[model samples]
Target chain A: MIQKGMSVIVKTVTKITLGFILLYAVYISLNGHTGPGGGFAGGVIVALSFVHIMLVFGKEMALKRLRSYVLRGLTCAGALIFLYAATVKFSGGCVPFGAFLEKSVSCRLFNSEITLPFCEMLIIGAGLFAIFVALVLLSKSDRYDSE
Target chain B: MIEIHLILLFMIAAAIVAVEARDLLSSVVAIGSVGIGLSLAFLILKAPDLAIMQLVVEIMSLVILVRATMRQDLPFSMSGRWVFNTFSTVLFMCVFLGAAYIALKNIPLGGGDFGIASGVYLREAIPATGAKNVVAAITSNYRLMDTLGEVAAIFTAVVGVMAIARRVGRPR
Candidate 1:
């Protein structure tokens, strides 16, 4: 497996910044309906963080941490979850295909009605990120004529 | 207006430099500068969402370009035919801009009609959706079909990238 990654400075910076980047992506997605960003922008950021890790720490490290199959699974699962969120009927009985979900059910911790759409964003972003990683890194086993 | 025009001029210069630079890395960085300028313009135009998206997308594209250039020794020299191609490009841009000007000359530019529409949206958006962010309110509530279509398009593009990458993965 390829072991070499970028220089130490990059790795250090990446280590420091990756978590914050991911958090910001979540913030963007969660604030989609209430703020500037929504699912697409947040998902791109989420994918970008993983891609950054892969770029800085090598594909092996990235793959070990987040396997190709796991990523593919996430993509499917996330899409399905997103679809569920889209099709699921609210209390008012309107299926929000355009991400018009509002949460009426009040929980103690999370009272935000925008939870479903946020959840959808999280899954989709993570899934898309994995997909991007798989695309660029190209696992050795994925090759048809393996050397 | 003057500030925006200045920013646009800077963007044009940056774009030219990006195209003219021979070093692959520097060219990519110059392109990034153009991206920054574009995002700045977007911010000036009061489109924070577009600005944010532009920056992220720019970085991603730069990363991909860096990777591709690293693997292959890309040719930098434009062939002798570049002059004609450049001329054609300039002609197209001029024609396009002229057409746009003619088309938009009659249509209202930030006038009474536009203000009224925005005023109505501002009045109705919050109470209807309980969203404080007007941009979010419009995207998620008002233009949800458009968002859905956009998501579908992105999904399709990702799927296509996967397929092409798969083909590239196989050894020749």
Candidate 2:
């Protein structure tokens, strides 16, 4: 019975709100340089958006949106992105993980430091989503075996 | 100042409700409110970054916790030693309150000095990182190594969870 998902009203609401949530997450992450929000916070919101779908529409439906392999790949890609920022040495930089990109005007969307938060946002969002999916699948299988 | 105190009072009330509620779902919801209250408190304290992170983390935690409780028939059982438990709880609360009082006694309630580091960050963050948000500049640029380690830690944790879940739940 739980496999079928929630009521129609809830599903409908989720359908309408999911896109907005994802967009908000992206905005928050990108605007980290300009405001209070950052990659970690944005990534958490992204994970919650997916979790919202899972709660209303069941694990299978959520997994269909973001497949397990894709989630894994995303997590890896996020880590690699951060590593690339850390390792790549631009000429004339003293520090290893120093700002390689040129700094433009303050409070703008594009900046040198944006890459770090962007990578963090991807890593956190995809990693957490993967963990949630694994745990949900595990619980399902446990219940299945017992039944 | 008064508003912050009121919000804190609300948080305390919500925490007590979370602990004492009989219904599992009610307890979860109560705790969730406590998290929201904390986020609000952060915003009031002028730390919007912390508030945003707190709010999103609270929502994600609520979702995961509610999912764990759903379809589970296990009741929240208490230890048989109710008297001891009560005594311990009261004692711990007293200790915590005492520590909190001692900790906060030296610090002013609101709008005090941000110290040398904060002053430097506030002054130079924009010039150095060209980011308007001091917190973002500090985390993403100044503390790049720290953020890298954090991301690495999370990646490792997710891999561990996947491994454990697969091992335990896989059908033979």
> Please, what are the lDDT tens digits per residue for candidate 1 over residues A56-90?
88766877898766766665665555445444432
**Model 2, TM vs. native:** 0.81
Residue B157 in candidate 2, Cα distance off native in Å: 2.8
**Residue pair clashes in candidate 2:** none
TM-score against truth, every candidate: 0.78, 0.81
Per-residue alpha-carbon lDDT of model 2 for A36-78, expressed as tens digits? 8988998998888888888788867788889888988988988
Which numbered prediction scores highest in DockQ against the true structure? Answer: 2
Q: Please compute DockQ, using alpha carbons, for every candidate against the native two-chain complex.
A: 0.36, 0.65
Cα deviation at B83, candidate 2, in Å, is 5.9
Best by TM-score: 2
Off by over 4 Å in 2: A1-3, A8-13, A89-112, A140-142, A145-147, B82-114, B167-172
Q: What DockQ was computed for model 1?
A: 0.36
Can you write out model 2's per-residue Cα lDDT over B1-172, one digit (the tens) per residue? 9989999999999999998987888989999999999999999999999999999899888887777534455655676989998999999999999999998897754446747667788889889877898887887777767877888888899899878875355678
